[model samples]
Target: MTDIVLLGAGGHARSVLAALALSGDRVRGYLAPVASDRLLGIEHLGGDDVLDAFDPEDVAIVVALGSTSSTALRRTLHIDAVSRGFTIATVVHPRAFVDPSVVLPPGVQVLAGSIVNAGARIGEGALINSGAIVEHDSVVGAHAHIAPGAVLAGDVTIGEGAHIGLGSRIVQGVTVGSGGVVGAGAVVITDVPAQTTVVGVPARPIEDKRMRNDA
Candidate 1:
């Protein structure tokens, strides 16, 4: 059994908890400085700095926060977990269909109703949100977030820290580069450059800005 300390206490955290339960991993509790004590009956353990309290060698850590239009936050937490010497564990819901040929790295999450087809490689810390569909031969990079109901066709390549918004559709063989964002209900038929934010029906570049300072 792997003992884990989860980070965050929001809705995303709840989803992570569900995934963890499905995976049957041993969860110690959650850590959130600003969150309340009651999180789905699991005690809210304290600040992130309290990671020092546990023996890093014996326990693993998982960031339960979300990736917004910004992927920077997700990357930060993932790096932090690695730095603390905690083995990251990927969480996948029982209801999700991950093909035997799919490769999922540490900290990856495939939520309920999500389907990852054969030959799909989902990288470290990536998230395949509920109802998403990743077709054959697709590669989803590290810390990427494929939002709810998004569809990635065959041979699609989603780069590191990318965010594919809700209900977005990416055509076959398309590449969405690292740190890119495809907004809700968009259709992506072309290559999206790294660190770009695209929106609308056919998904065009909207703006590019540092996530930390923009919000």
Candidate 2:
């Protein structure tokens, strides 16, 4: 079993720990100076700076930070760890249903109750949250997040760093662009542009409308 150094110590980090435990990967400890000193009785291993202490070959790293809209921080951490000769580990919860034909990239995390169907390709550092569904032939881009209970029908494509909000539904063939955010419970039938936020029954852009008082 490979030893791991987990980054982050938030709720997502806890989830990652559970998933890692369920998958039987040994965790050395977690980093993140701002977080609590211990999680589930596991002692803190200092901050990101501590990565320098461990030989990269001896400890594989995994980031447990969940993306919201921007993947900048998560991406930066992953890349930095790799550049320093640390291996980025992949963790899939035993409860996740990933098809035999599906391919998941390094640093990917598939939490409990997630379903990734055949022919689906999950990109690097992507997080498929609990109870999320990625139907046949769907593509999840790097660092993108399918929030809890979100559903993506067959052939759907989610771009990099995009966030499909909790319980949102995406119809087949729809593409959510990079950095796009679909709000909770939105039903998306049309393509969502990059860096935009959409919400509502059929999903429309939440334009920043400035209301002005009469002059």
Best by lDDT: 2
Tens-digit lDDT string for candidate 1 (76-124): 9789878878787778899999999787888888998999999999989
Top TM-score model: 1
Tens-digit lDDT track of model 2 for 155-181: 999999888999999999999998788
Residue 99 in model 1: shift from native, Å? 0.8
Per model, how many backbone clashes are there? 0, 0
Local lDDT at 201 for model 1: 76
lDDT of 2: 0.88
TM-score between model 1 and native: 0.93
Clashes of 1: 0
> What pairs collide in candidate 2?
none
| Each model's lDDT | 0.87, 0.88
Global lDDT of model 1? 0.87
